[model samples]
Target: MLKNIVLLSILMLSSCSTDRKVSDKVSIMLDVPVSPIKTYFKEHFDFESFIAIETTDSFLVSDIKKIVRSDDNILLLSGNRSVFLIDAHSGKLKVCIDKCGNGPGESKRIIDIAFNEELGQILLYNDFYKLLVFDLKGDFLSEVKVGEMYENVTCRRGEVLFYNKLNGYSCYPYMLKIYNLKNKTWRTVGDDIKIDFPIRSRGLQMVNSKRVWFNAPLDYKLYCFEDDTPAAHYRLDISMAKLSDDLIKKSISDPQTFFNEVSMGKIVYSLNSLRETENFLIFHSNQT
Candidate 1:
C-alpha cells in the first residue's frame, strides 16, 4: 500500500515549475464503448481522406512504431532501430536510415526519433548512447552525446523535449526534460520522479502545433510542455477506478489472475497513452 503511494508520486497534484496547477475538480468518468471502434471513429471524427503507403520489398518495415508528418514527407520510425522517410503524396519510400555501429553518424540503439524543424533534420536518440542527426535524404549530418535515457521524443524548432520514464530496469529520475541543440544545455521537469513502473515500459508525448502533451500512466493529470516548462493542462479524475498496488504486483507475477479478477468486474485504473485535439481529449484506458 505504501509503495503504491510513492510510485508515480511525481504526478501527484504537485505544482509545476510554471506555477500553474489545473483544478482537480475537472474530472471525467469515461463510458465503456458499447459500439465497435470503427463505428465509434466514423461517428465521432471527420474523415479527411486516407493515406496508403505503398509496400515494397526494398524497405521491409516491420514493427513500425511512430509516424511523424512534415509538409511534403513523413518520417517513420520502425522497431526503434531504423527510420524511413517517405513521400506523403506518392507514398513512396524516399530514404532509409539504418546504419548500425558505434562510429560517427551511427546509432548503437535508437531509443526514439523526432523531427527538428529548426535544423531541418532528424534527431535519433541512441538510448542515452548518442544523439544522431540526419537529413531527410538519410544523409548523416552530426551527433551529440547525451547521457539521459528517455523513451518518448518530440521537438519544436530548437528545443527537443523528452518524456523520461524510470521503469523497473531504468534509474534516470526525471519525468520530463528539455535539451537545447544550440548550447546543449538541459532543463528538467519533475526530477522528483522515482517511480518503478513495472507493467508499462514506454511513455507517451504527442505534439499538437506548438505544445507537447503527455500523461503519466495510471494517473489522471494531463501535462503539456509549453513555454519551456511543464504545466498541468487537465486533470482527468477517474478516481472511481482507483488503481491498486497489490493488484499491480499480482498482475506482474500472475496476469491470468489479474485478468480473471477484471473479468469478474474488478475496477482498475490502467490508462496509458493520451492525445488532445483542438476540441476533444482522447485517451486509452484498460477498463474498456
Candidate 2:
C-alpha cells in the first residue's frame, strides 16, 4: 500500500508541473494592445504678422544662403562669395567681408561662420581646411590651419566646436572636437557613441551661452554638454513610429531596397534634423 501511495504522489506532482507549463505557454502567447503615445504642443504663444524688410542699396545680396543672428546685426552669407554684416533694425549695411582669392583672409568656399563676443571677432571656416578669424569690423585677425574639412561649426566662450572628418574615420568613437583659442589645443568629446557611417553634416548648436547640444544624423536621441561634460537631461521617444531593428539595418546596408519598401508604405522612418528651444523641441519625420 505505501509503495502504491508513493507512485500516486509522483504522478500528481508531474501532472501539476505539466499544467504550469501549459499555463505559462498560454500567457506567453497572449496578445496585448499597447496604448498610443500622445504629443502636445504649446498653443498659448502669441503670433505676429510678417513684415518684409526692404534690402538697402548699400546691402546688395545676390543669393543669400544662410543667416546668423548677432546682438543687433545679422550676418548674411551670400552665394556670390560674400559675407555681409547688416543692422537688423535699420536694414543698413555695417560691414561686408568679400575676400575671395588665394591669399590670406581669402576663402574659396565658406562652410560655416561663428561670432566671438569677448574677442570681438568673427570666425569663418573655408573648404580649404582653414579657420579665418576676423574682427567685427571685417578686418583680418589671424588664420589657423584646421586638420580636416568641417561641414558645420560654431563658436562659444572663445572655443570653436567642430567635427573633423579625418578624425571621424580614424577615431571610431570620438567624432566631435573642441579647439581652444586660449591654449591652441584640440580636445575630443562625444566618446560614448560610435557612428558606423560617415556623416557629411553634423548637428551642433549652442544653447544660449553655456550649454551645447548635438545629435547624429541618423540617431533619434539628442545629447547635451555643459562645460565639456555630459549632463543628465531630456530624451526624445518616438518608439511608436520607429522602425524595427532589422529594417534599420537593412535600410543602412541596402538603401535602394529600403527606399522601395518605404515607397510601398511598408516601413516607417524617424526624424533627422532636430532643433530645440526653451519651450519646444521640433523635428521632422515621415509617417505612413
Winning model by lDDT: 1
**Which digits, one per residue and each the tens of the lDDT, describe model 1 over residues 131-247?**
788887788888876665666777776877766554464333235666788777776655454554445523344444435666654556666666555566666545346557786
How many collisions per candidate? 0, 0
- Candidate 2 lDDT over 60-160, as tens digits, reads 56666555666666677788378877666655667889888869999888877877766878888887788999887899989888867655677778888
- Compute the lDDT of residue 211 as modeled in candidate 1: 59
Worst 10 residues of 1 by lDDT: 5-14
Look at candidate 1 and give me any clashing residue pairs: none
Which residue pairs clash within candidate 2?
none
